[model samples]
Target: MSIAKRPNPLFRNLNAKIAALPMIATTLVVFLGCSIWTVIYSFSKSRALPVNEFVGFAQYERLFRTSRWLISLENIVIYGVLSLLISFVIGFILAALIDQKIRFEDTFRTIYLYPFALSFIVTGIVWQWILNPSLGIQETVRSWGFENFTFDLIANRGTVLYALLIAGIWQGTGFVMVLMLAGIRGVDREIWNAARIDGIPVWKTYLFVIVPMMRGVMVTTLVIVAAGIVKLYDLVVAMTQGGPGIASEVPAKYVYDFMFARANVGQALAASTVMLTTVLIILIPWVYLEYGKKKAQR
Candidate 1:
């Protein structure tokens, strides 16, 4: 008797899925696994090597008590808030201006977006040079009979953070522009026509109608900017090296110096854990709100 033939399940085409599996596995193994391991290490008395000895909350205690760590945390909040606000404002303005049917639209767009393509390493050096009092704009302007001009924020203890803000806004506003421009482009043409018919000023239309409608984009932009804030290390390192005596220190740099430079793995891990927790605290609420909004829409 002939056996009944069945289709071969193993022969089904899963080439795309198979191809993606390795990348997915690598990301989980490297990124997620390392994160878990780091969190665990924070609880232990790990030094030059990751030790298994448990020392519950001691590292955290030390981290909190340290003045430099506290300063770094404060600086992070200031930088994060100011950078986000400034970048958003500048990006919105640029997007609005570019949307005005200006000449050389592509050229202006490219010029604005080019900074986002650069690594912070390059931008940081350029900014440092530009902000340097003796060698850069201040000196050059002073040479040209503008001796009273004072752009020495970079050298001032109280104002160095604002220098960072300037650099950060320059680097990040481009990305904000791209995001906001996309949102602006996606806006219904009919809305603009209706606004014109009602004799509403362009600025009023954007403030009252366009911006309110782009709340989703705004939130997404904020999240993107927040991620940059949480991981702010490279720019500080390249620009100031946390110097003029910890004047420009940030949390990531604090973690790095402790981890590799000082060989204080436990403290480093504690600092990292704090950073991770702070990001989660900020992100979770935003995510939940977005999810609820989407659900309500459905």
Candidate 2:
């Protein structure tokens, strides 16, 4: 008698695969297809609409030479770098504080995390009001006897990006704190006890022992924050409107204006392609290294 043959691997999950075909196809068509189209058209010179005739890197050359684009890049770099450093440091501190099992722990966490629940638009609007020189902090302070005090960070081009940075950090730190708290809680209890037995300071325990174990969670948080930084559009729109002379403009805003308002499709797509390339450059190596390590471990 012949033995029964094994089922084909491709057919093992055939039903599930069939059910997922629509989603897979949608992603391939809607996202991947559009992205490929954008990249291809970026090489062509176009206005008011995309032109099929290729002009090579002319769009990219103009994009780099544009003063507004250069200013936007500088603003994003400063905002991104500071946001990364400040959020990580403050989030870790807040998480460590909460992990001490302080009284009213739940209340404290809720208060700290409340801001994160608000959308970026709301956050930017709220901060814009608070930073308004004539009506907000400066007015309030002047009324209270500091008449000569000036707080116009949002109006001045030099300090406007930092104003955005402050709002960004305020709205984001709570989420970062929660992620860090989860990582802290996931650390082994035995390790905490061991540190205590060795008479290690609380801060030392966190700095040396607990943090090293939370590397995975930290990496995940960093990736999320970096992605948000790359797409810095809504908050800038809601708050500054790329004002103070486009000092607060970011890449996403640049792409939006070029595509819709200016109708320069070629330059718009070129900027988008550059943004996509930057993201892939950052993420591909991270994915390879992280997953490669996991596969080796297994």
Candidate 3:
């Protein structure tokens, strides 16, 4: 007969806890603390800087009513949706095709991923030149033979966002492909063999089995691409300068303009709060579902 000894939870993994203290403190102080501060200031009528006087939701009201802010919201939503869908489809397709173990695989992969190494500013500038009416694709095609070639998507206000979309896809698809490829490769060899034994077509197997199994990877890629879309300022600035009359304005640019240019910290914080809410809306559910499932399984 022996007394059962219970382990103290607080002392468990003490070394790991000590190692993580710096990061935890940084996250709490830098990220969480600043977020709360921003939210508090958002409700205040801060003109040049943060102040204590509460203004209710006047900043929010003005933010919503502003035409530029509204346009920015609409643009980001459209860009985010289109970019996510297109990147996912194109990336998965490329990954699947490459997974067939073709020759020159390394070469093709390097070629695809090379663009991803370039910064968004560089990508935007390069694409800006390529889409130029006189010096880019249009000029090259016209020089060859087609005198009526007009491949200038960047110039037209109606199609400028699409131009940005093209540049974004070119820059990001490689990384997405790499992620999807890793996920696809990670599927057990036994699973593939079993699917084959069951006489499942390759496309069917991929569509039904592999895609469903790779949900986690897909979600990760979605969050990355969605975050990029939400913070779409530098690209627009470098390429279009929100040109053709604010045709490609985005929320990030709106925040910057309000904060620095207009000197309206409250309005900027209000806009910032909206962006933060948008991100949290997408993030919270994913985290809940993912971790909840893992914890339940454990």
Candidate 4:
């Protein structure tokens, strides 16, 4: 017996159409709707109760004039840059070390990557405890006949940012290590063999050849780190609560305080809008360049 096979064009098209409908609806309803709502809210005279009365740019004016907002913006830039640079450096070093055909490689890799699995809340608290003046390293060292011991960045206004940077680097370096290691492993082994044959020092080969070859992965790592910086909230909250005064206040925490604690939704929304705009300003060009590269490849 011979069986007849039939191609159903309509069914395939219908399936494709159905598959896309949910995504389209979700984008419109969830993302676009929320964006529009937020924009609308930013213009209102809303306080604890969101009033429908439109107030034009009053909220934005207030937001721009706020010293806290300005400081938060500055802090974000400082934190983002420092965190990205430090994390990248540490991660690269750890990855390179681990890639050297070491024993217990998996164990070491897992140990390094373990921080990425932890919530910032937990990590931040642990770091905070470790950095605390009375209970942590400073006190311990002081007790050990080092009366002049001083690691009080957490309590100092000028150096608290560095303390946060230390915590951020500790938390984020692991992920960077994993990404960089993967990039390193994906590199052609023949290149290493060739370098070995040429008597090129491993360090020189890494610096001159391997590092340059990992540009895509490096960029990926940078973008991820940048996103983390932009959305930096949990760690700041858990560790400092933007404390020792508003010295360490970040934009996200500023927004949160205005939104809920201070009952100023309009200002909060304005701050949030500013953050969104800033992120776009920074990311859009990079994203476009990446997109263009992919398109050219295609």
What TM-score fits each model? 0.91, 0.94, 0.92, 0.90
Taken over the whole model, the C-alpha lDDT of each candidate is 0.90, 0.91, 0.91, 0.89
lDDT of 4 by residue, 1-298 (tens): 1223554655556778798999989899888898778888899999887789999999999988998998899999988888888888889999999999999999999998898889999888999999999999999999999999999999988989998988888888999999999999899999999999999999898888899999989987787678768889999999999988889999999989988899888889988888888777778978998999999999
lDDT of 3 by residue, 163-206 (tens): 99999999999999999999999888898999999999999999
User: Relative to the unseen true structure, what is the C-alpha lDDT of residue 288 in candidate 4, on a scale of 0 to 100?
Assistant: 93
Query: Which candidate number would show the highest TM-score if scored against the true structure?
Result: 2
**Model 1, position 13: C-alpha lDDT score:** 57
Q: How accurate locally is residue 93 in candidate 4, as Cα lDDT from 0 to 100?
A: 90
Where model 3 places Cα greater than 4 Å from the true spot, the runs are 1-21
- Model 2 backbone overlap count: 0
Each candidate: RMSD: 2.8, 2.6, 3.9, 4.0
State the weakest 10-residue window (summed lDDT) of model 3: 1-10
Candidate 2 positional error at 37, Å:
1.6
